[model samples]
Target chain A: MSGTFIGMPAFSPPTLPAFSPPTLPAFPTAAKEAVRNPTLRRNLRYATHTIRAKRAAAVSELDDWAALREAGRQIKDHTLRHLDRYLLQLEESVTAAGGVVHWAADADEANRIVTGLVKATGESEVVKVKSMATQEIGLNEALAAEGIHAYETDLAELIVQLGRDRPSHILVPAIHRNRGEIRDIFTHEMSEWGRPAPEGLSDTPAELAEAARLHLREKFLRAKVGISGANFMVAETGTLAVFESEGNGRMCLTLPETLISVVGIEKLVPTWRDLEVFLQTLPRSSTAERMNPYTSMWTGTTDDDGPRTFHLVLLDNGRTDTLADRVGRQALRCIRCSACLNVCPVYERAGGHAYGSVYPGPIGAILSPQLRGTASDIDASLPYASSLCGACYEVCPVAIDIPEVLVHLRERVVEGGPAVRQGAKVTLRPARGHAAERAAMRAARWTFRHPGALRAGQRLASGTRRLVPRTLPGPGRAWSATRDLPKLPPEPFREWWRRTHRPGGQAPADRQEDQR
Target chain B: MSSRDVILGRVRRALADVPDDDTPYEVAVQRGYRRAHGERSIGETVDLLAENLADYRALVHRTDAARLPGLLARLLAGRGARSVLVPPGLPADWLAGELPTRVADDAELTPHQLDRVDSVITGCAVAIAETGTIVLDAGPDQGRRRITLVPDHHICVVRVPGQVVSSVPEALGRLDPARPLTWISGPSATSDIELDRVEGVHGPRTLEVVLTSED
Candidate 1:
């Protein structure tokens, strides 16, 4: 049975258009477009607020939530610190369990390895679970380039694929689309994929979910190869776990003859027991459920149960660069719960597409700049997307200090500094257009060093307080356009302090002393 | 160098700043979380399991060993299921009464064949009360993973007290890591459209969990 792929004949590849990654504008430009769409703003607002309230309630059910969050953080930290040791151990365990482990240094290498594996099986189509890692690497496009079709089986992913749209949210990829939009996508696009939507489909979520169930079932039953990405890979036991609400994850993981899982090296914990912490925190934080509907955990392979041939591709893809910075490395501790996205005020207004990556919201603001490097216009602008309200950090299950990383990335963008890219150490020049800000900062530093210049400047500013405009001219106009400038005090603090506390005058400190 | 060696070298280089006397894994993490939420007796735990399972839209049934077959018959008859998939290790007495056509889970049963079956009945390895989860380890009674998944209706029998745990941590202790385990909270559900959760997608739309105790 292992000689031939099981369940179905080798079908011809479907004729889908080749995917070319889109070049997106910077955060502010994209955000300006997003906020103007009233429909998008309302959709994001309702989804985020609803999930936010439910998540808070789910988390409050457990009194020891803080302890669980800390344990999750420390476990990830400890694993990442000694990652080489744990990865080697994991490789040994998986190999011992009759599975082949492959390592890919970058997205191109990972894609090449996966494509070759699928070609080896002689299968033109593969079923997929909803996986962030696979999306991050653009695996579907890579396979499509090789004449292999990758079918996304998750309900949200199905909507996104059918609509030919990019994923907007981590947990719910099609969060940007309302039920009416989704019904249209399914009704119009489902036939082109495999099965057509039922006649006269309605706009209710239940009917939409039912349509998705029927459309994906045909592909699942006949699938010969399955591809996925795991939530956690236990180093001690060589077990990979995928947490999902839909049954698509189970069908993709179980029915196929060959299963290939592309997982990030950082998605590992030291032992199986560590799952106790994340299992409690992830579901409640992500979907606001006590536990997701289905969580599948499998070690390499068994004789009579699931997939017969198991392959694990451990992907690096710029993770090593993200690990170099001590402060920024905390972003690796993310379990992808996406609680931060729901609570983010900026994400609510600008929406997920504005972030310009598969990961959006506050986590994306920090992670994209680090992993992709702050070289592109979007990557450099991502660091400034947040208001530093710190809501993301508060809702984080692993306690990733996203605000700290965002600020650190801002420093990386403004000042030329040392960074690692593709396993090579390279120094970077400050991003262009920041020269004015940099020069102003330098001049302020110089003036602060000399007390006479600072005092003279303060007096001059105080004397000409009436001359200050309500808004500044030139580049500062955009900064002050939406904000009202604070009024200048009648005199500087030093002058006021000197006048209020003269030797003959009754000082406030003396009055307090007298009262005492 | 091979890609494996290159990636490992990169990881080592990334950690060059780590001190030699760094805290080891044993002392690095603090695990102070509770094993279970609130304390409950075994019976109360099982009752909580029923309540929480129902909360997620799974049908919960309580019956003793003698009446289990009758309850199973009634459920199958109620659903008007023509064919029921049976695992190898399921007790014969559980289906002794007259029922639908039985399809045995075996090598001959393909995924497509399982798709046509109206329902699947099996015993679970362990059930968690706090999260309303039933874990299947592809055990003898549970059969292959595909049997419970492809069918539209699933009737999972859990032996109370012996198979029930209060929380996820406790459930993990009873499960083995080597086997492929599936933890099912309720039937398949999705909150994909506007974050409004709708149960029944791809998986068995009807998840009937029967808690049978041999008193």
Candidate 2:
């Protein structure tokens, strides 16, 4: 638990690290307001339906999509298992190729490393691609604290940054904003950032696109430093690949003099050969295309083409911990296709903002809690966000069993005390409420093991069936308010079976032949 | 510390714990890239290139060297494309009596000028079957990458059977890693957060393939 301890700013208390008890706007209230916005709902419905349909069609074209998904999952799992080895391989390969690599254990170290890198460059401004890793680390805000500016080049990301609004979706960050809202944000906010929007700018797609293009063009041309997060990293040759529809990612990757990529250690695949699976699954899964439009790949740096210097920061904030959990480790296999998000009923209604992290929707629910640790109200609340509908697991390109993981984490949250931060097996303590649940489970376990005790308990419960209340009287009342509590049977199945056919409680399979 | 040293230091430290033994590349990773990427066998790879090209709303046709000129004439006459843009190294007979052909001299014309032409046809460097991918290396017949990108329609003629590979590794082995390789999968597309899809955002909306097999 005690490593370097370098300037790790705690969020609230002395012990808690920065954003440990991660702060979020009261989501229940915000989501209530969001649901009421008719224009937003219309925009979301139109957008999600369109993408979902295209994804389905694109996915359908492949006869072995299921096998492909399994292969993607297996590859990711294998990589995560040997992450330390692959990371070292990537580092050696990159260094040999003249590229630099940095290790960041947590958010503070990551931000400091990147900010220091930019400071060394002597540039106060950097053009950035739409990178979820940067948002996760709050890198832009960290840079802003030091008076450095980070310009967002992606069109959707630009809208979110300009409006000072959080991204509400993964694939399309500005999915929450309508055409009219975007036009207003552009016209009013564009000048402060760079180029001003034209007078009387309309809400048309053409005009809004032009305004964003004009606004970002200058940054792309003049910026000396560029930052990005790669979709995948090749360990064999130390290459990184970024898939983008717009040419903005390509420009940011190529135009700058010094390029810094903050990549998740989980992003590495063993070789370029492994990249093929994702190259196929990722595009069709996320953008619903047979393939991505612009796929820019660079192996370290080269002379007279692309960036002269390249630095890749491999981040493992909580990936190792996540990878240790056998059942929950599959969450790291996510390719960020956002197909699960698109199909999620909860995300569709609540939007991405309510989840309160860079990653939103069903994947976010499981991933956030595991990565950040289930310490805060937000992390605790995220596990319960899903309906356990299993749609996410169904549509996921990697076939991660999201519903199963959600349930497992819920049990861990409800039944155990905080685990030792650095331990082999999470040790459990008997807290009061958890003790009650544990006692009940233990009693049930004992009764099931002993037939005599089981019979007595069943008969006792069956006798009191009429006295059972339809709803609980206290805390359970609140839980039952939104759901139906199952009613007790007049007679236990054991008793019914005993009286009708198996009088001595002999095996039912033996009685079946006698009855015939 | 020197800039190179600083960067390399961080890399070394991060990778400090990795084991010395180098495990073979992840098998599943290679399988992922190869499967459903383009086509399986050489025959299927050619078929996939044809079908995918058609699926991208590209026109496709099959012909032999003996009938190549006649097929070209029929295609050009069918479209009534008065003229076509040909790359500098494109075989003369490929367009023999096809149309009034114009050679694409990269030094003389810009992308804007290339956009004015009705069609630009070239041969691909290699075609991947699993992802329906075609690689362009800016070779003599392939012209500049921008030329293919800017034009309205592209007729890419792939030599059937031989130019196809089942996996990206096979394709990568044949490719010169230093060359500028442009991998084309399908028509360009983008999606909004709500998942609305829009095609032809940047690249061509239509792709055409003419699979020429000697056998």
How many angstroms is residue B139 displaced in model 1 relative to the true structure, after the best TM-score fit? 0.8
Q: What share of the true interface contacts does candidate 1 keep?
A: 0.89
Across residues A1-516, which tens digit of lDDT does each residue of candidate 1 receive?
121343232453333332222466899999999999999999999999999999999999999999999999989988989999999999999998888999999989999999999999998889999888888888888898887788999998888887878888999988999989999999988876777899999999999888988888989988889999999999999999999988999999999999999999999998999998999999999999999999999999999778999999999988988988878889989899999999999999999888998889999998888888888888889999999999999999999999989988899899979999988999999988577788879999999999889988989987898999999787677778989998776667676666568777656664444323
Candidate-wise lDDT, in order: 0.90, 0.72
Error of 1 at B13 (Å): 1.1
Predicted chain A of candidate 2: TM-score: 0.86
Candidate 1 local lDDT, residue B15:
87
Evaluated at residue A235, the lDDT of candidate 2 is: 85
Recovery fraction of native interface contacts for candidate 2: 0.21
lDDT for model 1, please: 0.90
lDDT of 1 by residue, B54-98 (tens): 999999999989999999999999999999999999999999877
DockQ of every model listed?
A: 0.89, 0.17
